[model samples]
Target: METNLTYEAAYKELTEIAQEIENESVSVDVLADKVKRASELIEFCQTKLRATETEVNKIIKQMENQ
Candidate 1:
């Protein structure tokens, strides 16, 4: 089973995309596609982050009950 992405990995990818977008050499048409993909990635990262937080909270609650 695959675990969710770690914060570092997600942040690194986001940073890379930003850097690529900043470079003037990218074409206009491709830029829109890139931006759309980046948006989706951002949403996925956010969802994963929230899920991780929820799981952590559940684990902590269970530990406290033990």
Candidate 2:
């Protein structure tokens, strides 16, 4: 997993992977690999979202204080 992956990109990939899994388009041989990649993307997206939320909250608090 590259640290440079943007939240939107990771999210898009995750959605695509989920669709493939749901639609049974992924072959059984590569299912494990897809699952692993999806897990990584999910983690990346979650971390990015948490960081963004923290930053947004900090800015909001600062605005309120001022």
Candidate 3:
């Protein structure tokens, strides 16, 4: 897992993983690892999206209040 992974990078990796799995390119041994990494990327992407959304909303509220 990458400690300093950006949202775009995580999303790109997730997409690639999905494609690989869909294509059945990953062997059984490595499939589990790929799935696990995809899970982590999903979690990271979700958290980043939520935090960005909250920040955007807060900024909007502040602007409205001004």
Candidate 4:
């Protein structure tokens, strides 16, 4: 996995992986790898969301204090 993966790219890959899993398109040999990748992507997305939420809250607090 690349360290520079953006949130959007990770999210897109996650969606594709989910579709593949749902449709049973992934072969048994590669199923584990796909699930692992999805887990990584999900973690990345969750971290990004948490960071964004924190920043937004800070900005709102500043605005309210003004």
Q: Give the lDDT of residue 62 in candidate 3.
A: 100
Cα lDDT tens digits, model 3, 1-66, are 678899999999999999999999999999999999999999999999999999999999999999
The lDDT, on a scale of 0 to 1, for candidate 2 is: 0.94
lDDT to native, each model:
0.79, 0.94, 0.96, 0.97
User: Model 1 off-target regions past 4 Å?
Assistant: 1-11
> Which of the two, 3 or 4, has more TM-score?
3
Q: Over the stretch 1-66, how does candidate 4's per-residue lDDT look in tens digits?
A: 688989999999999999999999999999999999999899999999999999999999999999
Q: Is candidate 2 or candidate 3 better by lDDT?
A: 3
The residue-by-residue lDDT of candidate 2 on 1-66, one tens digit each, is 885888888999999999999999999999999999998998888888999999999999999999
Candidate 4: residue 34 Cα off by (Å)? 0.3
Look at candidate 2 and give me any clashing residue pairs.
none
TM-score of each candidate? 0.76, 0.94, 0.96, 0.94
Worst 10 residues of 3 by lDDT: 1-10
- For TM-score, candidate 1 versus 4, the one ahead is 4
- The order of the candidates by lDDT, greatest first, is 4, 3, 2, 1
**Model 4 score (lDDT):** 0.97
Model 1 alpha-carbon miss at residue 25, Å: 3.1
| Deviation from native of the Cα of residue 52 in model 2, angstroms | 0.5
How many clashing pairs does model 1 include? 0
